[model samples]
Target chain A: MREPVPEKTFIGIPASDGIAIGPAFCYIPAELTIPVCAAGTVDEEMTRFDMACKRARVELQSLYEAIEKRAGKEEASIFEAHQEMLSDPALEGKVRAEVEIGETVEQALVKATKELASLLAGMDNELFAARALDVKDVGHRILRILLGLPDTALSAVTETSIIIAEDLTPSDTASLDPKLTLGFITAQGGLTSHSAILARTLGLPAIVGMGAGLLEKVPSGTSIILDGRTGEMIFAPGGETIARYKQIKAKRESHLLSLKAAVEKDAHTANGRRVEVTANVGEAASARDAMEHGAEGIGLLRTEFLYLEDTQPPSEEKQYHIYREIFAVMSGRPVIVRTLDIGGDKPPSYFPFPNEMNPFLGWRAIRISLDEPELFKTQLRAILRAAVGHHARIMFPMVSDLDELRRAREIVEVVKRGLEVASVEFAGDVPVGIMVETPAAAVLVDVLAEASDFFSLGTNDLTQYTMAVDRGNAKVSGLFQPLHPAVLRLIRQTIDAGHAKGKWVGMCGELAGMTKAIPILLGFGLDEFSMNPRAIPEAKYLIGKLTDEKARDIAGQAMSFGTAAEIETYMKGVLALL
Target chain B: MAEATIQVKHKIGLHARPASLFVQTANKFSSKIKVRNLTAKVDFVDAKSIIMVLTLGVMKDHEVLIQTDGVDADTALGALTSLIKNNFGET
Candidate 1:
C-alpha cells in the first residue's frame, strides 16, 4: 500500500501586496452556456439568434438610458457601444454562417463571439484589447438570454473571506465590497486585470494567474494562507505552517499597533528631515480608518464615490453635509478634496463621452470639469464651504497645461466671489493645487509651481502616461513600471521644480505606498507621502530607518540607469544593504 | 469601380465614433465598398463592417484608399471623400 501525496501549495503572480489567512470563499460565476441540443433547422436557429439579439439590444438600451440619467453621458456610452457591437453585421454574418453549417444556435453564437473577442485580445493596442472585454460582455448577455439565467450577484459578500474564482469581469470587480473581501485568488488574470486593479485600489491582498482547475481542486470553506507579496498559497496547511503563519501575522499586527500608538508624532528621517504622512481615502468613513492607521490628515479625499451608484448627482447640500462629516472626523486636520476626476476607463454607469480612440489622452479630469462649469462649480463650492470650519484644500487632477491651471483658478475665483456675494461663510484663502499626472504637466512643473500653491505628483497616471502603458490592459500591465528611470527622473525633476519655487510637493499615488520606492522618494526631498491607510505604519517605519543623505545618494544613482530592469535590480541591491 | 485616396483628417484618425460613422455611411450606398489602410499596407476589408474597419488601426495623417463598385459607386466614393475632408464632423 502507498500513501497519497497531499496537494498543499500553489504559486501565482503577485497582483497586490500583503498577507492573509482566511477561510476560502470560492465564488463561481455562472458559466456561459446553453443546453445540449441537436442542430435545429437553419431558419429556426437563426430566428432564435435574432430574438436573443433583440432582447440583448433592449437590455443594453435601458442600461444606457439608466446610466445616462444620473452618472452622466460618458458612462452611459459604454452600453451604446455594446448595443452597436450586438448589431454588428460582421458578427451576425459569422453566426449565421456557423448556423448554416449545421451548428446549434447557441454553439454558433458562442463560437462567433469568442472568435471576435480573441481577435481583439490578440491586438497589440490597448484600445483594441479593451474592446475584447466589451465583446465578451455582449456575448455573455446573449448567452444569459439563451440560458435563462439571472445576473451573478457579488453584492452579498457580507463576511470577510478570501475570494477564489476563475476570473472576475469588470462588473464583478465593481460590485466587490472592499470591507468584506479579505483578498482574492484567481486562476486566470494578469496584474493589470480589472480584478487586480480593484484589489490594489481597495488595498486587498490578491494573486492572479494561478492556473486553471483551481476551483475544482480546492473546495469552499477550506483554510488557506495567501502571501500576496510573495505570490504563494498554502491549502489546508499542516501544524508547523499554520504556527509559522500565525506567528508572522501576530508580529505584523503588534508592529502596526505600536505604530498606531505613535500616530500623533510627525515622521522624520534619521537625519531629522521631517515629512508629512497622510492617507488617500475614497469615502467619508475612511477618514476614521486613516486616523486609526496613524495618518496625520487626509491627503487625497476622492469625491467621485458620491457621484456613483446614484440615480442623480449628489445635490450641493448633500455633498456639503458629507464633506462636513468627513471634516468633523478629521478634527481640523487638512483634507485635500479632489473634485470629480472621472472619464476614460474610469467612467461610472451614467456619463456620456464621445467615443475616442485613445481615451487616456482624451478629455478627462479637469478637462471635463472645465467643460461643465456648473458641475465643477457645485463641487468647488461644496469643498470651499466644507473648509469654513476645517483645514481643507482643493486639488485638481490631470492639469496638463498652464492654461488649464489658470482656467481652473479662474473658476475658483468665481466660486469665491459667489460665496462672498451671498455672505456664505467659507475658507476663501484655502490653497489651490494641481496634480502633475501627465508628462506635459511634469515638463512644465517649474511654471506650474509658480502659479499653484503646491503640487502632488499622481504617480499612477504619471507612470502610465510616461510609459504609454494602459494599466487596465493585462497584456502590457507589466510595462506600467513606476521604477523606470524616466518616471524616477520625472519625480525628481518635479520635486526640484516645486522646491525651487518655494512650493511644497507631495505624492498621493500607489507609488507613495510602495516600500521599494520609498527610499528614492525620501531622498528626493518629497515633503509629503500619502497612500492607503494600511501601508502608513510600514512606510513610517522605513522612513525612520533611512538617513536623508543616503536616500539622496541612492536616488541620484537610480536616475543614471538606462532601463527599468536595471533600476529594479539596483533597487534590490540597495534594499539588501538597508 | 470608383475609388479615391483620402487622408483621414479627424484628430483621432479613423476609429471610435468616426469609424462608426464611416461604416454607417458606406452601408447606405448600393455598392460593395472596401477600404485599405495605406500605412499598414493591409488587404482590403469590407467597409461596412465596423469591427473590421476598427481593425485597420488607422490614425490621423494616415492615408486610406476607399473603393466602391455598383450602381452608387460614384455617390459612395464622393461621400467618403467629403467625410474625410470634413474631419468626420470633428472641430
Candidate 2:
C-alpha cells in the first residue's frame, strides 16, 4: 500500500494564473439530502422549507460578499450570474409551493430538482441542457448540507487536494476558494470548451478524461506534474524529469528575453549564412499567419487542400484565383506549389475507390495520377493556367520509377500546349520536380535528377518504408525509427545524387524540424528544409548555432548508434552542448 | 434512335449520389431518358421519387435496358456507359 498523501495533490492541465503553495486537504461538502418527516403538520413542513431557503441564501450571499470584497468589481462579475441562478424566483416558488401541499421538505427538494432539470433540458442549446444537470447537483448538495449529511463536492486535491469529478458547474466553481483548488478534472471537454478556455486563462493545470478510479490511485496531497503539450502525467516524478524540466524552463525564459533582439534582426547561422524561415500553409487564409510569424515566404503551398472541399473538379479559373492570392501575399518571394497528391489515405468518399489491402503502399499520390490520365491532365492544365506570370515551382509525388516521371512530364506538356494555344502569360521556367519518397526513388536519384529540376524528400513515408514499419501500427511503431541509420543513408544518397546532377534538393518532412536532424540536414548540404511554421524559430535557433563542420561530426557520431534510445541520448547531449 | 441493354457491371447499382450525378448529366442533353432495372423503366430526374430506382437496386452483372431518343442520344449512351463502367471511381 502507498503512503498517505502528506501534502495536497493535484494532477491536471494547469489553468488560471498565479501560484500559491498551501496545506493539502480537500473540502468534500457532503451530499445535502434532507430526511423526510412526512407525518409532520402542513404548517410545520412549510416552516421547514422556509428554514432551508433562509440557510441557502445566507451561505450564497456570504460567498457573493466575500468575492465582491476580495476580487473587486470586475473579477466579481461571474458570481453575480451564479447568485441570480441560486435565488431564481421560479426555483424558490417551486420548493415553497411543494411544501404547502403536504410534501415533506425532502420530497419538496426532489420535486423542485426534477422540474428545474426538465425546464433547462427543454432548451435547444447544449449549455442550457448541461446546466439542467448542474442545478440538480447543486440542489442535492444544498439539501444534504441542510440535513447535516457529510460532504459531496468532489475535492480536487493537489500537491494538496485537487478536485476530480465528472463535472463541476459554474456555481460550484464560484463557491470554491480559488487558492485551495489547484486544478480541475472532468470526463469530457474539448480544447476549446469553456472549462478549458477558462482554465488556460487562469493558468490552472488540468487534465480531462483520465477515465475513472483516479482519486483512488492518487490520494489527496500527492506531488505531480501536468505536461499539457505532450499530454503526459507524472504520478510521482523522479529527479531526472524534474531537473530536465527546470533546465528547459530556464532556456524558455532566456528565449523570451532574446525575442525582442531577434525581432529586429534577420535569421542567420553562426557562420554568417542567412537561412530563409518561411511559414507552411494548407490554405491562403493562413497567409496572414505567415506574415505575423515573420515568414519570408511560404515554403510549401499545399494546393491539394483546395480540391478536397468540393466533389466536382475545381475549374481552372478558381485554381488561378487561389494561386494568385498566395502569390500576392508573398509579393516577390517564391511559393513552392505541390500538385494534388490524392487517392492514398485521403481518398474522397464521393469518388469511392475500391478498398485496398494495404493503402499506404497502394495506388496513392502520383500513382493515382498515372492511372487517371485525364484527371492528371486537368490538374496539370489548371496549374499551368494558374502559374501565369507567377513564381511557382511545381512538384509531383510518388515517383518510384522512370516511367512515372516521364508520364507526369507528358501530361505537363499537354497542359503547356493548352496554355500556349490560349496565349496565357506564364513562366516557361516554373521548374518541375519529383518527390523522393520511396527507397527505390531515393537510390535512383541520379537518373531522376536528370529529368527533374529538383527533388523534395518526403521523409515521413521514406522513414516508415525504410524501416519496414507502419507508422500507425503500435506493435511495430517503436521500430519505426525516424533517425535510423537505414533512413539517414537514403537521405544522404538522395541529396548527393541530386547535387551530382546539377539539381537542388530540399526536404519536406518532420525530420526538417527535429533539432538534431536539422544540423544533420544542414551538414548534408540540403538547399532548403521545409517544415510546419511553428518549428521555424526552434530549428533556426539550432541551425544558427551549428557550424557545418560541427554538424558533419554529429552526423558521423549518429550513424554509430545501435538503438533508437542511444540515438536519442546522443542527440540530447548535442542539444545540451548547443 | 439507339437502344441497348447494358449490365450493371459495378457491384453497387447506379443509385444514390451516382444516380443523382447521372441524372444531372442526362438533363444536360435533349434526350428522353429511361433506365430499366429488368422490366421497370425508372424515371431519371425526379429526386423525390428516385427511391423507386433504389427499390429495384440492381446489383453487378444484372442487365438493364436503356432507351433514349434525341439529337445526341448516342453520345448520352456513350457517356453514361463510361461513368457506369468506371464504378464512379470504385475501380
Candidate 3:
C-alpha cells in the first residue's frame, strides 16, 4: 500500500507573467573545497599553471562566443574583460611570486586573485566593488577547472522543469536554457533584482522572495504548478488542482494569442475615441521593440542607465549619442525623455548621497538636478541637441512644487542660450513637461499647467506617496495598490485639471497597462497610456472592446466605492462582462 | 627616459575597459613603462599590468605621472599621453 503526497501552496512576489506546470528542478549549487597540498618544484608548478591558463582561455573564448550569439556583444564584453584579467601580466607575476615562495599552484592562484579582488573591493566606489565580484567569478572558474570539477550544476538539467533556488547569480542565469528551464521560483529577490529582471527579459515566468523555507518544502522532481501573474505556486498538487490550473493556463495562452493577432490595430474605444498607446522604454533596443509591437510613441524614456554604470557622470557628447540612438529608433514618433531620476534607491557611485532615513522623500530627482546646475545643464544640452529633426520632448520627474519647475526651466533656457552662442545646432521648440508623481503636483496641476506644456501621471510614486507605503517592503506591499480609490481620485484630478488648461495628460505607470484599470482611465480622459512593451498589445486589444459611455459608468461606480478592495472587486466584475 | 604628467578624465579613471586598453597600449613598446597616481600620492607600478594600474586607485580628474625608458620610450610616452588626453576614446 502507498500513501499519496499531500498538496502544499506557497506565495511570492510576482516578477513576470504566464503559467508554468512541470516537475520542480530544485537547484542546489555544489560548493568547491580546495585541498591542501605540498608545492612541487617551481619549474613543474609553472608548467601546471601554464596548462591551466590555456584551458581557462579556451573555455572563456567559447563562453564569450556563446553569450554573444544568445544575448549581444555588449553582454559578452564582460567575458572579454575576464579574458584580459586571466592573461594580465601583473596577476601572473603576483602568482609566480607566490609559487617561488614554496606555495602550491592552487594556493598561489587563490592568493593572487584575492589580492586583486580586495584592492578593487577596498575602493569606496560601487562600480569597483562590482568589478571585485567579476574577478572572484573568473578566479573561481579557473579554480574549478584546476580542481577537475564539472562546469556548473544547472548544465546537468536535461528535461523540462521549473527551477527553484535560493537565488540565481548572473552566471547561473546565463546557463539557463529557455527550452528546459520552464520558470523560476527563488527563495529570495525583489522585483528589481538581477534574476527577476533576467527572467522578464527571457520571457520566463518567475516568482521570487518566497522566503528561506521554500527550499525545504520543495524537493527535486516534485510536481509543481505556478502562476507568475498571481505569484501562486503549488507543490505536489492533487489531480483536481492540476486540472484547474491547466484550464487557467490554456485560457491565458489563447487570450495572449488573440491579443498578439491584433497587434497592428490602433487603440480606440467603441465610441471612436482615440487614445495613444505607447511604451516606457529604457534603451534603444527596447524602443525599437516597442515600435514593432505598435507602440504609438515612447511615453517615457528613462535617462538613468547612462549614469548608473560608470563611476562618474557621462559626458555631454556621450549622452547626446545615446539619446540620438533612441530618437533614431523611434523614427519621428513622439519620444518623451524623462530627465535623470536618481537618489533614493538608485544612488550612483560617483554622486555622494546624504544618509537619510526617508530617502524617497529626501533630496532626490529634481532636487539634485536643481542643486547641480552644471550636471543638469549638460543633460539638457544633450537632449536639445539630440532632438534636432526628431519628435523629442523633455520631462522633469519628482517635481512637488512650482519653484522646482521654474528653476529647472530656467536652466533649460540657460542651456539653450549657451548653445545658440556656441553655434551648436539644437531643436528650439521642444516641449517641456513634468511628471505628476507628487500629491502636490496632482493637486496643483491647473496652476502648474500654466507654465508646463503637458502632464504625465507617474502613478507608481503617486500611489506610494498617497498611501505612505514602501512598494519594496514585503510587509506593507499589499497596501501599495495603484487602483485604490485615493489613487484613482488623484489620477482623475490630474487628467481633468490638465485638460482644463488645454494640456494633454498621459499616464506612464504599471496602472496604465493593467487590464482592469484601462477602461477607468479611458473614462477619466487620459490622452495616452504607456507601459512595458510586452503589455502594449493586450492593453490595446482590451481598449478596442469598450464604449466610452460604459467605461464612464464603470469609473463612476468604482468611485462610489470607499476602499481599494471594493474597487478592485468591482473592476474584476466589469472585466468579466467585457 | 621620456615622461608626461596628465590628468585622467575618463569617467571611471584608469579602470575597467580603459585600464585594459591602457595596458594593451603600454605592451606595444619595448620600453619599461610605469605610472604613479599624483593625487593619491601612490608609488609607480608597471603600466603593462592591469592589476597594477588599478591598484593606483586613480579616479576622474586625478593627475598621473607616466615614465618610460628604452628605445621606444618617446613613442610609448606619446601614445599613453594621447590616450589619456582623448579620454581613452570612450566618448
TM-score, cand. 2: 0.58
Q: What is the DockQ of each candidate?
A: 0.17, 0.02, 0.34
lDDT of 1 by residue, A412-527 (tens): 99999999999998897899998889999888999887669999999999999999998899999999999888998899999998999999899999999988889999999999
Chain B TM, per prediction: 0.96, 0.72, 0.98
Writing each residue's lDDT as its tens digit, candidate 3 over A377-495 gives 99999999999999999999999889889989999999999999999999999999999999999999988987799999999999999999999999999999999999999999999
- CA deviation > 4 Å runs, candidate 1: A1-264, A344-351, B1-91
Compared with the true structure, what per-residue lDDT tens digits does model 2 show for residues A403-429? 889888888887787778888766667
Q: Indicate the residue-level lDDT of A253 in model 1.
A: 68
Minimum summed lDDT over a 10-residue window in model 2 chain A is located at: A17-26
Best by lDDT: 3
Candidate 2 error regions (>4 Å): A1-8, A14-191, A198-251, A257-266, A278-280, A285-291, A329-331, A344-346, A350-357, A388-390, B1-91
The RMSD (Cα, Å) of candidate 3 is 7.8
Model 3 chain A weakest 10-residue run by lDDT: A125-134
Best by DockQ: 3
Give a tens-digit lDDT track for model 2, residues B33-87: 6667673443332211222233344555666666678898898877776666555
- TM-score for the B chain of model 3: 0.98
